[model samples]
Target: MSLPPQANSTRKALVLFSGGQDSTACLAWALERYAQVETIGFDYGQRHRIELDCRQTVRRELAAQFPAWGAKLGDDHVLDLALLGQISDTALTESRAIEMQANGLPNTFVPGRNLLFLSFAATLAYRRGASVLVGGMCETDYSGYPDCRDNTLKALQVALSLGLDQSMTIETPLMFITKAQTWALTEQLGGAALNELVIEHTHTCYLGERQQRHAWGYGCGSCPACELRAQGYEGFLAQQRAGA
Candidate 1:
């Protein structure tokens, strides 16, 4: 199906989804601006298998709203980056240490995760006949991961254009937007009403432990991941209470 047009006709977008806050927010963001939107996620074999499960759940959530949202995010593509996970012994894979910051870069940095995710998304865009790829990489309020930088996205865009026959665009809707702003965006896109998704469906726990989640998510509440989600939700809740 075709996506709706905002101001510049129809924009095609491919969302790199993790079924988490940022990606889910970006999915909603892309739907408003693009004519067609597709989502791609990775199964890097992180210790948190719950994340994969949540991703599927989030996909189903979006699928249920496909027609209502008026944008098409086709089937969820799960790529086996298990090898990448094996080599990644940092916080993202096997680090025993807890995150130091509440909402900044942590030890869980995967060297080339976003790189691989975007590469695969670009390839899928080519096959699926899309012209844009959207992701939820926030530099303003993230753990300071290098991959979330603007330059990284630009570099990937260049690399993909050079490596592939078809030219595709990568859209980082949440690049500059803070996590708080992301929460606002999700609410603006009508996702906040789906409070269950905001809480249960998305996997934000770096440890990947479902038993660890609170009303917010699988966050340790002290770790950077949990802290950020908490902080952002605080902003979201406050705004919701204030009515814009």
Candidate 2:
């Protein structure tokens, strides 16, 4: 679907952009749904920055590709959560050795980071007059962050509405979708404008390797991000073959 014009615009969305495939696709999805789409990013010292850069590429691409629409990447609304380190000992917050288990949440969990980010995003959305805040948070495909679950999202919705005294929607476009669906959505939105360019540009890896795969256009294809990405790509391929 095409993005509706501002004249008929009643809904606005603030996307939590990390510039990964999912978030970027979610941004595109928001574009199709909301008349105005704004993005907010966080530089919480998450240990990897490729994702942020990936977000930048998407913004730049939007500016270049959708110049008529004037959809530049929204402000780099990142809050430095460096202070969280003082109280956070999570693997993502500390130099602690995080071992990946076969099943269950990993050590990469950053305590209350998503909650805090959403709270900040909610406040920003209220100030911006947005009706919704879109995020790339996923449940079907995720890194085991508890906050990414469906229940957490629903609860956050309630908390934000109550705490802010305003109704703002937290939209997770990829919550039920696998990684492959995300890529396909990007492709569907702008074809080469997203799928090929995004795969090559975004930093979806947790390991944050920039030069590991120049051909693929992303990061270390061995990390958790890579695994999920690989699965998504594989699913995308399967869909292509099935023609469904």
TM-score of model 2 vs. true structure? 0.88
TM-scores of the candidates are 0.86, 0.88
RMSD per prediction, one decimal? 3.8, 3.0
lDDT of 2 by residue, 26-142 (tens): 877777666777889887766675577667767777667766434533555766767776677666555555566455768777778789889999988898888788888888887
Residue 20 miss distance in model 1 (angstroms): 0.7
Candidate 2, superposed: residue stretches over 4 Å from native: 1-8, 72-74, 95-98, 101-103, 214-216
**Number of residue pairs clashing in candidate 2, backbone atoms closer than 3 angstroms, sequence gap of 3 or more or interchain:** 3
What tens-digit string does per-residue lDDT give for candidate 1 at 1-244?
Answer: 1232477337667788887788887777777777677677788877665677787777777667556554455556777888998888677777588655465646688888888888888888888878888888878988778988999899889889888866778778778777777776766666456555667778787777666757666666776677888888788678677975
Task: Give the poorly placed runs of model 1, Cα more than 4 Å off.
Answer: 1-5, 8-11, 99-105, 240-244
Task: Tell me the whole-model lDDT of each prediction, alpha carbons only.
Answer: 0.75, 0.74
* Backbone clash count for every predicted candidate, in the order shown: 8, 3
